[model samples]
Target: MRVGIYLDDQGRSLDVVVEAARDGAKAGFASAWLTQFAGWDALTALAVVGRDAPGIELGTAVVPTYPRHPLVLASQALTVQAAVGNRLTLGIGVSHRVIVEEQFGYSFDRPVDHLREYLSVLGPLLRGESVSHRGATLTAVGAVDAPGTKPPSLLIGALGPAMLRTAGELADGTVTTWTGPATLADHIVPTITRAARAAGRPDPRVVALTFVCVTSDADARRGWVAQRFAMVGQLPSYRAVFDREGVDGPGDTVILGDEASVERQIRRLASAGVTELVALPIGSAQEQATTTDLLVGLNTRAG
Candidate 1:
């Protein structure tokens, strides 16, 4: 399976982010992805990174879909693709109700419907086709013109069955988090693969994102994950996945241990049908470095 690195762009300068991406590329990672949080703009920062870091793929772990119109997002994604030499993978999703409703002030009703409609408009625009869509949740009446650029591979952040079906039918694949290997093997991989086959599309990519820390102090590292990402386990979507995986909390999903143990868990993910593994290295600087080096070595072996 392909191995990638997820970079947290929170509280960091663009130059620092670019250097990180370059380092990932130099270390032989297949890709580098950034998330769309309250901090840096992921696509814009990736465009800057692409100027300095060549060869490696650049992607957004996700950009929230509710905030931007399909037209606007397509334009930005295509622009980034052009800037990145067609190395952009656009990962998008309908974020949680708390963020969409409480913060963005948009009603979070029938999110699956929203995702379906959003992709209907987004897919065509990314391919440089004019769209005149008028659906219940979204509408588009224009096209994005980005010459000399191919459509970046589109992935949806989908966990539930309906969302996975939609992602299989519409997008190239799904990007998932907080899900374990057993769940991916029994539920996620089969459901999405069946949907894609039924839709006459090729097998969809299953990109699994998880926190990893190579440490002898496994208990402390797990506790750090539990404390730092406590809110994630409480989120409804992730909670459902946790229940599906039969895990108690976000810390359980993390791959934390010595190098051998951590490598074994990652191999389990690969055996479970994950097309790619995106590692969010966690813990102290030394621990993070150890995790990255292990992942790089694994990636090299895979290649």
Candidate 2:
């Protein structure tokens, strides 16, 4: 699997995100990703980030698609692409109900329909063509005005079968979080692959995100992770993936163990058809350092 690192970008400045990505690349990570948190916008930050580390792939685990019109997002992504020499993967999603309806005040009704329409507009615009679409939830009548060389690949944060169908049809692949290998092999991989083959699209890229902490104190760290991500199991989309993997919560899917154990589970993710793994290192400072050291070692060994 292509090993990537997830930088902590919540509420941090663009400079910090860029710095962290640079640091990760220097540490021999195959790619580095940023989340769509409250601080710097992921793609926008990557405009400058890739400059700090010339060739590393920089991606957003996702930026919510509801707020930005596809035309607008396409333009922004293209801008980042042109700036960074096309080292961007635009991961977009119809985010959770509370965040969309409550936080952003956007209606979360008919999300699958919304994502379908959203991708229809987004795909054409990314290809440097005009999109004139009018769906139930959104409309776009224009194309992005940007140089679209080396078009960034698009990934949907798809968890359910319907969403996976949409992603396989329209997007380059799916980006997943709190999803384990069994779920990927049994439910996620099959659903998306079937859809992609039916649509005659290229094999879908599966990027799995799992929290990892290389620690001697596995149980204590797992307890911390459970409390930290306690709310994820309640989220409908993530909960579905958890249910598929027979996991009770997000914490259950985390890959927390000693170095050998952690690497072995990571290899299982690859076996289960994960094209890339965006490892979100969790735990205390010491744990983080140990995990980073192991990841760096793996990258070096691969090289």
TM-score top scorer = 1
The C-alpha TM-scores of every prediction are 0.98, 0.95
RMSD in order of candidates: 1.0, 1.6
Clashes (backbone N, CA, C under 3 Å), per candidate, total: 0, 0
> Model 1 Cα displacement at 252 (Å)?
0.8
**Model 2, stretches more than 4 Å misplaced?**
300-303
For residues 210-282, write the lDDT of model 1, one tens digit per residue. Answer: 9999998888888877888899988999999899889888888999899999999999999999999999898
Clash list (residue pairs), candidate 1: none
